[model samples]
Target: MIPQSALAIVALFASLVLLVMGNSSLGTIAALRLEIEGYEPGAIGIVLALTSLGFVLGSLFGIRIVQRVGHIRAFAVFAGIAAVAALSHPLHVSIPGWMLFRLVLGFCIAGLMLVTESWINSHATPQSRGSLLATYMVLFFLAASSGQFIVALGDPGMYGLFVIAAIFIILSLVPISLTRSTPPQMKRGKRLAFSVLWARSELGLGGAAVSGVVLGAFGIVGPVYGYEMGLTVEEIAVFMGISILAAMVVQWPMGYLSDYLPRRLVIVCVTGAAVGMALFTAAFGQRSSMHLYGGVALFYALAACIYPLSLALTHDMLAKHQIVPASSLLLLANGLGAVAGPAIGGAAITLLGPSGLFLFLAAALGLLLLLALHSFASERAPLVREQSHCVGIAPVSTAVIIDLDPRQESG
Candidate 1:
């Protein structure tokens, strides 16, 4: 049986799963649709990159809306906006028009995530926070992975998929709107500057940026790559879905290994493995379906852990109070990298073809490996006498969710 605490927050989790499923389906559909529309890879890259820009802007400023209007109202507003944005894709087919809609969708989705995460954080006891966060991470990946299958529901070239996406977004409003619990008050906290965070742990910040670049680029362009490789819509869905599920499978084991070994050493090993997987995909991915799916899954499984491991590494060097604020700066660094990822990934695909995507990933992770090696050698000694245990966190999230981390003080 579920604990009362868990039972109490069922509405928030239900709402989150619905919102993410809709948004995730829309993201995959956008890439597939654009490919069918005859747009150049470079143009699609630019259009998709704008969504990251909007996400960064929303994470930074959307909190003000939450503060002013309260969580329940803010969620409704964001969800309403998101549903409309998803519907708008079917109505407007031009590049510029879709770009505008993508931006709006990104902004509103970030706001929706912000409200839900913050509400969950507020209600959590320190003892239960870790369990809750772990559950949240698992559900998040499941919803996102399952969402890929939603692409098979209708043809990308037609209006049916977009309508289905909008319906999912609109349906998300039902659970939260009907909940009886009072909303939690939003807390204002001091945020660390990037300069301060970098000075404290360059490897942590650098690793996050690199993780963002690799993950963000793949998220936007992987579907296009699959489509280019002559996969059907169902095949592409399985390819993307399995990759996300692989990340969820690998995170805990990787996090556990970091707890026993030197975190920096674990990071170096993971980065090295990621580089190898990226190269493997570049060389053999298009040769066969099994090779392609397996290589991509292994590559993503390694790449996804970097952000959370970086967070754990950074936490090792800071006081308890500093961890929350520092996380925001780390996220900002990641977001900036995400904003640039699509442009670079697209250009590579344009110049080198579908294989260019994996080649680029290999190069990026190789650089991060060098940085990790240097940091490990230079520091030599551990940053703290007792290193913090790693936690699984989604890289694309608002600062509010940082409060839910079990490492933070309950007060």
Candidate 2:
């Protein structure tokens, strides 16, 4: 038989693949269906923002829940709620109803992810940490990107798609729910101290929030952008899927490169590219051209890399105990951006029309790009000194990213 840790990793990866597939599919389906039902952009955006709110709340409160119950139990609870929540989408068609459903799923998913990450933390050895993190990143993006294509498999107008999503969620519970292994006890971090994080890594914290805006809007609103631009549902699915895949394709190379180069310069260069692509997207979004999708893919590839780079930088600056606090601060920044992105994206959609979504994103990323460049000039020596010896981290999210930090091995 495979070693227990190896089995756990495989199970978690497979389960996460199913969960993310269902989750990603649910988001696009909700967006497209809500639009088709004649919901306004502002209302749609609010519903989307509510999910981030729930996720933020979950991250804040979920540690205790995981501690009271073991990780597997927590996983089962969250998965059950999420599965039920997925099925509820088709049953209730009101804006408020969907918002509540999304909120619940978001909260559950956050806790679910925490449980998974803690489990992963225990399973990973120092020798395998870096490769494990990279694998996690790849699996996460691949599942999410592939899940977008699942939206194309069925009509969003009907119940079949929602049922399919629910099925995937339920199937995800199979492996771990049946396993006999003990779930890791939830590890508690030090109290969150945002002021310290900001003092130490302003660029990292600020960039994390900005990446949230960029990533949150793209993930939640990209399909809406495509729909309003007159793409067929299938075409929109492919557009979202392909764009995410482009990010997946680019991330390993970007991480490897950031290892050797200055993260700030890499961030600026990547964000600069994303800014150009966003401008391209804004200019050409409404047109029926394949080139627009190409622009989006490239834009997202660069855009997606920014957060991890910022995370790597943040990890380098903080001491061992300080790392978790910083991670919490980064998540707080991420949550703020996630909440802001949809509302801004929606307002832009309302005021400037569909292309306005990308326009707003361009503006957000543009500001962050400038911040990164300014940091290059103003905060050069510390980063330069640190870059020579800093360890890399792919902070996965606000709640559980530090587990993957290479520094954790020695700390």
Candidate 3:
């Protein structure tokens, strides 16, 4: 019999392909919308903002849908919707049509992501949970990074972007369709326990909240920021690609470091570094396109690991049973933060200029860092003894790793 871990690895890999396709396709469109459709920056911001909003809504509903229909069916349904929506981008040709499509696309992606993450979380045992989650995170980061690189393959004007996206999204569907492993049975769907979860471990709650905001900013405004800075579509894509790459490369180290160090300390340092980088980049202002790419890459790399580092820390603080509630709380925090991050970032760019993007992000990170430090200081409990043998985490299950609460349930 094939091992569950191997199946999970396959599922996560598949999800990565879809992630690249979905995110990259959107990235390319964002970069090209101004030139191709002649939309104003504000309109562009609205489209991106709506998409983030759709994702937040999707996460809430996806859990219920998956509960009823099962993971595999839900995956196919959403993936198919995403594929069709992506293809339809070329058909609309109008800005309003495109906006509607983007919102649909956003909603569809949320379903796909939630279903995938839930599947993974359901199957993983505490013994191997860390490794499993870490591996899945690594693949996710890599795919997200590579999606941006797809822009370099061809012009956004041609059908190439849509086709590329379709290919990735379609490919993402395969492993789950073929796998024989049964997805874990859902008990009740995850619900927000915000106050309790936050009170239990401020670091975990704060981490989820900050990550959502950071992701929203990066997803919604990252491309737009590059466009405003005079980067060509190709360069903008490459710049985003580089940022994701930095995140991908840094994840494993961050994960292992979390295992060995105090998680709150690690989070503080990462958040502080992110704040510093954003401030420096905003102040420095890229002289040339190349400079922007390099700076953005560095900034992304520094900031991207915050989520995983926070995840590791959350796990460290809680008892085994507490993980589920903690994970659910984190997801809620992330959704709320994600919604706020982009709109605020976009408004900053509109009001203050492109550098305002970084300025806004820096402010957000500054708050996160302060919270992390404060959380650490207030907790006076003795550190748990380091276990000689850490838990062995399996690969992510396609059913639940992408979009649901990171853990399906608490106790």
Clashes of 3: 23
The runs of at least 3 residues in candidate 3 whose Cα sits more than 4 Å from the true structure, single-residue gaps closed, are 1-12, 34-36, 93-96, 118-131, 189-192, 288-291, 381-399, 402-411
Q: Work out the TM-score per prediction.
A: 0.97, 0.95, 0.84
Model 2 bad stretches (over 4 Å) = 383-385, 388-398
Error of 2 at 349 (Å): 1.0
Ten residues in a row with the worst lDDT in model 1?
379-388
lDDT agreement with native, every candidate: 0.88, 0.80, 0.68
What does the lDDT read for residue 250 in candidate 3?
Answer: 69
Cand. 3 Cα-lDDT: 0.68
Q: What TM-score does model 2 achieve against the real structure?
A: 0.95
Candidate 3, which ten residues in sequence have the lowest lDDT sum?
Answer: 387-396
- lDDT of each residue in 1-411, candidate 2, tens digit only: 788778878888788788878888888998888888888776788788877877888888887888997777788898899889988888889988998998998888788777777777777778987777778878888888888888888888888888888888878888767655677766667775788788888889989999888888888888888888888988988899988888888877887788777878888888888899999988875564666788888988888888778877887777777776777778778887887888788778878888899889999998998888888889843445455233333323446756776766655
TM-score of candidate 3 versus the correct structure, residues matched by position: 0.84
